[model samples]
Target: MSTTPLEAGIIPLVDAAPLIIAREIGFAEEEGLDLRLHRAPSWSSLRDMLALGQIDAAHMLSAMPVAMALGLGGFAERIDVLSVLSVNGNVIGCSLDLAARMRAAGYGFDFVDATAAGRALIAAAGDTPRIGVPFPFSMHAELLYHWLGALGVQAPQALRVVTVPPPLMAQAMAAGEIDAFCVGAPWGSTAVEDGVGELLLPTTAIRAFAPEKVLAVRHTWAEAEPDLTRRLMRAVWRAGRWLDQEDNCLTASEILARPDYLNVSSEVVERSLTGRLVISPRGDLRSVPNYLVFFRGAAAYPWRSQAALMAHSLAARSGLDRAAAVKAARSIFRTDLYRQNLRDLGAEMPGATDKVEGAMRDPTAVASEAGHLILEPDAFFDGFIFDPTGDE
Candidate 1:
């Protein structure tokens, strides 16, 4: 087997573990692939690097490919989501002063009531607070808008949305640059550790099973090297499965905490891996199952409905044609490619390529090639469901 060298780009976040683990644990080597990982500090830089062919693939935000497909970022080339990397690992954090103000305003930081949190935030800050997100087109931004909008706080008008890199979020908050932030894990934990912020709510409170990050590749590269793509997908899938085991959580965190990787403390990274999050500076802990999902419950499947949901949100926010945006976004998920490449490996993939998003209210058994697959509830907090094929 010839060793094919491939460069993959990633941001320093807990969700980028699968790509790092695959290369570190010999999964890529076993597939006859030599993976070179590149660390990118910001989302736009990583997106541009992937777009300009600076990297073969990347660990990208779930909505990025859809954004590229809709021409939102002015990138000409189309990108494809080969698989999901992580789901529902984001948390909203507010500065210590803002948190104290919210508490004084009769808000309970229970981390379950998103509407109350939003209303309290509005009351305490009075439309003047600046909230930072990792990117404009990320699940962090979408969930923040959805949660606040559901509570009658109009976005970009009632409050400001700012873009800050995830790694720099803690420092930004400490420096009084942003009052609050909705970002992926470890960074939020870092803020809590640094005595700068307190956790307000998890993105799961807005929408459980929110797709967070994906294994993305350029369409041109995927089409030109079909075999290599299959090999890469299989290797990454194996790494994800290895990551799902409870015993491997600490080891995974340690690997991610390396200076060459996330460059954070292993203890902070382990919080997300173990689903035991410290929500406050005073060590208030919460047990959130499936916090940073890698493999269980078809977590890696590239669902078209997920893409369509992102498309609808972006279209509604940006004033684009909903139908056209949904159509273009649906093509980027590449569910057909996922099924074609992973089925032979006996992957427990959903029989249907698309389903009603956020409709399941329980762990229901569904049709699958390899017997039954139990899908967990992905209901929205407002009891809304996204029907990609219907007038949602």
Candidate 2:
């Protein structure tokens, strides 16, 4: 079979596993796609590459396409999120000095309680705590804002938000550029490995099902090349499904650790995959089930609600019209295209395109065409449920 060549941009993080796995494990090849994965230096560069048509698609931050639609990132191009590639894979860590201070202040790094962690961090970190995030328009930023704001930190206003690439997070911490960071694994694990920082909490503790990275493409490209878009989405979806299996963790980690990919140790990558993370240099392990989700519980489904929730936060922060921002953001997540492409492949199609974000607190069955779709817990730590339909 003759395959159509396609290039996709990705940052070197463990969450980029689906795209790498698709190419290495023959999913992309089986779908008649010659997928070329490019490792971008940072999320900003990857976003620009997708916007400028340097790549056909990108493993992007879930909030990126929304931010572009709302005219926040200074990029004029319209990008569509084809699917959610990964979810809740971020870790919030702090420098060794701050960790020591928090511990001295009696804050245990429980790695489960977002409220406790946030309050402790606020108290430990000075009046203007510097926090590093992979990108400004990222779930890491959004999660940090929500987590800190709920704990009375006043968020981005009162805090110093620094933009540091994931791979450089440890270095930034060591150089004292940032007192704390919210980054994707295994970079957060890298900080622990390097003994520069210690993991405080996984972002999942803040928002249980935050969409971390997305499979994104130029809106025009997706519209013009429907067949190719469908093939790529299906290929990546299959890769995510494979990665979701418990037995495939070791192999997936090994593949992701290749030099062409993350280039980190396979063991470090495996920690994120298995959700058994070492939180400190002392080898204190924390078992966080579903810490990083690729395909289970409609993890690949790009729900419009997720985009709206992100838009709601972005608009409030950027002084944009909230309702208009949400309206624009919802269209970027292509639920219709998701159904059109993956319906026949035995992929469970959720009956609803939009739901109340942060409403599900447990693995609850929801309406779906297959009638057996149970969504994972997606509650925010503050118990806030965002109704996308009621945005007005």
Candidate 3:
């Protein structure tokens, strides 16, 4: 049996587990794919690699495809999101100096409660808070804007936004280049390990069930190679399902900790997998359920509403027309492709392609083909629900 060789780009982060697992755990091979993983230095480089046909697919920021579709980010290539790879794995942390200031100002670092955390972050950050995100068009930036803007900070205007790659975030903090950062684990956990920063809040505290990363490919490539696309999606989907199982955490962490992959300690990687984080140098432990969701509760489903929300944010910030942006962005999340690939594999899929973003407050059962799809809580901290159809 001849396997099709496919190259994919990824950044070194815990959320890259699905791609790593698909290769390491034999899922990709099972699907007749010779999956080759390339670790890029940053999100921008990875995005460009995919754009330039350097890689067939990528573990990409969810907002990247949408931002590209909206004509932001200076990339004109169309990138389609095949499926969501991981959901809600980001952490907002502050430098040791900022943490001390926040602590002295009576901020408890509760590691939840976005509203209180936002207020305290604002007060402690003074007039203009210097914050770091992996990319300007990433969910980290969008959530930061949404979370802080809701809490009376003007955001992006009243804040100094810095673009630091995930691997370099801890170094940026240690050097006092960034006052705070919102990044994916185990990079955030790495900062704590390095004694440079303390975790303040998981992005889940801002918006539960945010689409963090997607399995993305060039739109032209997906269309040209439908069979390969289908095979790749199924392979990664299987890996995500396996990752969500509690028993696989140890093995998955070990695989991800290899030097070829994330290259961090398995213990550090496992913390993100299990949602148990050591937030501070003093070792304050916080357990957050569903912190880095891989597959449960339709986490891998490519919801167009999620894309619309990201598009809405990008448009509002970039001066693009909201309606046009949403329309373009929603099409990029390829739910049709997801169904075409994974439906026969007993993958439970939501019957609807889009939903009111941030509306679910609990594990609510929705209409699905399998009749057992219960969506996890997806409410925004401020209780804002975005109706993709009702953009007025």
The model with the greater TM-score, 1 or 3, is 3
Task: Give candidate 3 regions above 4 Å deviation.
Answer: none
For candidate 3, what is the lDDT?
A: 0.91
Error of 2 at 141 (Å): 0.3
Q: State each model's CA lDDT, in order.
A: 0.88, 0.91, 0.91
Alpha-carbon runs more than 4 Å astray in model 2? none
Off by over 4 Å in 1: none
State the lDDT of candidate 3 residue by residue for 131-186, as single tens digits: 99999888999999999888878866888889998778999888889999999888
lDDT of 2 by residue, 166-262 (tens): 7788899899999999988888888898999999998889989989999999999999999999999999999999999999988998999988888
Work out the TM-score per prediction: 0.97, 0.98, 0.98
Ranking the candidates on lDDT from highest down gives 3, 2, 1
Candidate 1's TM-score: 0.97
Worst 10 residues of 3 by lDDT: 151-160
lDDT of 1 by residue, 66-183 (tens): 9989999858789999999998899899999898998987888888877788788888876667899989999998888888787777764766888998778888898888999998
Candidate 1 least-lDDT 10 residues: 150-159
